[model samples]
Target: MKNYHTHTKRCYHAIDNEEEYVKAAIQSGYTELGFSDHTPWHYDSSFHSTMRMEEDKLDGYVNTLLKLREKYKNQISIKIGLECEYFPKYMDWLKQMLHDYPIDYIILGNHYDDTDETGIYFGRPLTKQQLTKYVDNCIKAIETGLYSYVAHPDLAYYDTDDEFYLQQMRRLCETAKKHHMPLEFNLLGYKTHRQYPNETFFRLAKTVGNKIIIGTDAHESDALLDMKTYHLAKQYIERLGLELTEEIHFLR
Candidate 1:
């Protein structure tokens, strides 16, 4: 199996060293493993958080992963990437980082909207305007053709109005279908019992024919290929009759 959304301790919220994750992937029978730790942003200092690694640590992150890739080349295919929230202001920076680093891909994880001026985390309650803006940003990010897939597309997690949720979600799925961008059915959501893998979102995606990929979104070593989580995702796919893709293709 292949998983492209693993994380590293560099992202403070996660635990364990990078190598531990690699070993876990091997033990879990993953043929292809990707390290897509939460991306470090070049945002203004005032907007910084402990959510990601520091900008200076990017080189080390890449170098360490490259070394592991070579070391484990005979055992598994290793890819290096970053999971990032799309902020238009940092698009240029992202482009340059991709060019400068040996990164293979980026997954758009729209966990936050608004801006340094007034941003709101997705985990908290959102205003109607914020929800609309979240969907708009997701669309704009996909249009950039820079991300491999939109990770946790159901992360908007709105339960206010069924009609509004369906409308916005359908729009996102339709856009992804048009661009041939796959949407990730995140396993972390199932493991954490978070709002994602929302039945309504995937049901609509199935109707719209949006491609799907299962992401472990592994924040800790043990989460790399948790069979229980994998089974849960598999059941969801089977139940929804969703089309699942094994790999991601970068637009660039």
Candidate 2:
């Protein structure tokens, strides 16, 4: 098995070092593992983000993972990546980082609006206008060919009974299918019973013929050791009739 949605302590919200995760992946019988800790943006304003790593930590994040990728080459394949948000004003800086770093891949988190500096978190209930903007923003990000997949693609918590919810997410799913970007059925959400990785969204995505990928979303090293949850999620998605994938595009 392979997982590409792992995180590291450098992101502030995650725990342990990169090595711990690598070791845990090996113990969990995974053939490949990726570290996609939350990325730091070069904010023009003095605003700081509490969830991601600092801008200066970017080099260390990549370098440390590169060394581990080499060290563990005999045992498990390691990928160096970041869980990034598509902030329009900061795309230039993000592009520079992608070009400068040996980043294997990145996944779109889409946690906030144009910028987290706006304090508009997408996880919360959003207004109709905000939802429309959110879907459009995600579509634009997918079109960039920068992100490997959409992590927790059903993150926005809209009331499922509303037809508007289905319409907006269908648009997002169709775009993902068009771009060949798999939507992640995040294991972290499954283990924690988070509202996301929602069945309704996946059903809609299946109707759009979007492919599904399972992401460990491991905030802690031990999270990788949970084989039961992983298999359960695997069976769940497979039974949904959604095509499952383990491959992700590299940042070539």
Candidate 3:
């Protein structure tokens, strides 16, 4: 119930404000809420490839959240976090950023597997070979001892069949299990795609028996505190007999 990957408008695609998100969390009866905006990757001035809080606004963003945390002390607990996109080259800098800043936690969001030849993404697809490499990089990122959780391990499943994608997801599950890292069952994709976990990915995740954590991945005030898709997905997970770990606690 601790929504760990909520976003704000500075990310360019979100539609919520910090105060609105906090109020929504309280209204939904959550005790804790963490705002994790997408961290900026080093890209050569390309809007499509890189989405983040501009360097100039970074201080304001962090300070505003810090102030909100104090303001909402009695109402709820707020944590400042980052849903970092994976880029191995920036690992050191990312580490310093988190250490130097007042960040509470970090989560992995493997939006891009690698930097393209152009030093920026340009509609490249994930190959089986590339998927394996990318996942390994993500695991290494986890080994860096920075991330608290990982979001959407099956993100590159658009091109493959169930069996093929399941194999990919299993690698992530195995890695997470080995590292004791938690996997987030994101709900935003369900709202847009109209199928939770994209079918192949969810079925495979359930079969593999990885420790699961529900994440709404909300970018709006309403969804920041929502449990609709999460509840629906949990129902399906129950029907499938996937084991929910004893630590599956809801914030709301």
Candidate 4:
């Protein structure tokens, strides 16, 4: 499968060079690959580290990927993009950046709530109310008509229990269906051995019947080498009876 949310070492939490990732993609039998390293937010935020690629490096990142795209045009289709964390608090500037950059695609990674407040991936623990707001912001981000696909839609439940987070997941799946937006099913969750969105969310999505977009959420070159989790997730998806598609749309 094509990994649409691949990352590079340039992103502080990730570790791997672009070339190494390209080589891995070829070896993994992928036909298409998307390099969507985390885009540094314009403002300081608690969800991510400040050590990510600087503004000046954006061009180099683009140029390097363009060169690779050329080199692997025949072997694999490569697309360079960014996984943007949406913040309605900074909508004006956020919209400006989206227009300014020649980004081929955008992945909505809702790393924070509407108030620019809290998150589960970071040190901040969110309340049930906060979780609701975070999911709302993610849905709003998709409604804005900017992103190609929503990355980790179930991530909002990172801090909550399955029983408490179930309704929220249902609402999230409902929103995805309303907007015709796809929720990324990340395999890294299984690799890291986290409860992840929990099978509860996946089962709910199945009952509600929302579109599933498969993504490895690979932060490094060997990220996809974890074949066990991929197969397990595939089995889960098959059990749920949801169709996974490859037609990357929205911005195209």
- Provide TM-scores for the models: 0.95, 0.98, 0.85, 0.88
Across 1-252, the per-residue lDDT of candidate 3 in tens digits comes to 567778898888888789999999999887888888887654544544336776566688899999999999999988888888667777777777877788888788876655431332212466667666666767777677677777766565445474665666678777777777777767787667733355566666667666767677878888955577667877866676665542322212
What are the Cα lDDT values of the candidates? 0.86, 0.92, 0.70, 0.75
* Root-mean-square deviation of candidate 3: 3.7
The residue pairs in collision within model 3 are: 1-251
lDDT of 1 by residue, 49-168 (tens): 778898989999999999999999999999999998887887888889999998899999998884433577775666677778888999999999888999999888578357887888
Model 4 / residue 177 / CA error / Å:
1.2
Ranking by TM-score: 2, 1, 4, 3
Selected candidate, larger lDDT, 2 vs 3: 2
| Cα error of candidate 4 at position 88, Å | 1.3
Q: Which pairs of residues have clashing backbones in candidate 1?
A: none
- Can you tell me which runs of candidate 1 are displaced by over 4 Å? 114-117
User: How does candidate 1 fare on TM-score?
Assistant: 0.95
User: Over the stretch 1-252, how does candidate 4's per-residue lDDT look in tens digits?
Assistant: 677888898877788888889999898888988988887665555453554576667778888898999998999989877888777767777677667766678888777554334434421466777777777777788788777887877676444455667776677788787877788887777667655645667777888888888788888788867666777887878777887876676353
Ranking by lDDT: 2, 1, 4, 3
**Model 2: per-residue lDDT, tens digit, 106-184?**
9999999999988488889998888888899999999999999999998887887789999999899999999999999
Off by over 4 Å in 4: 44-48, 115-125, 158-164, 250-252
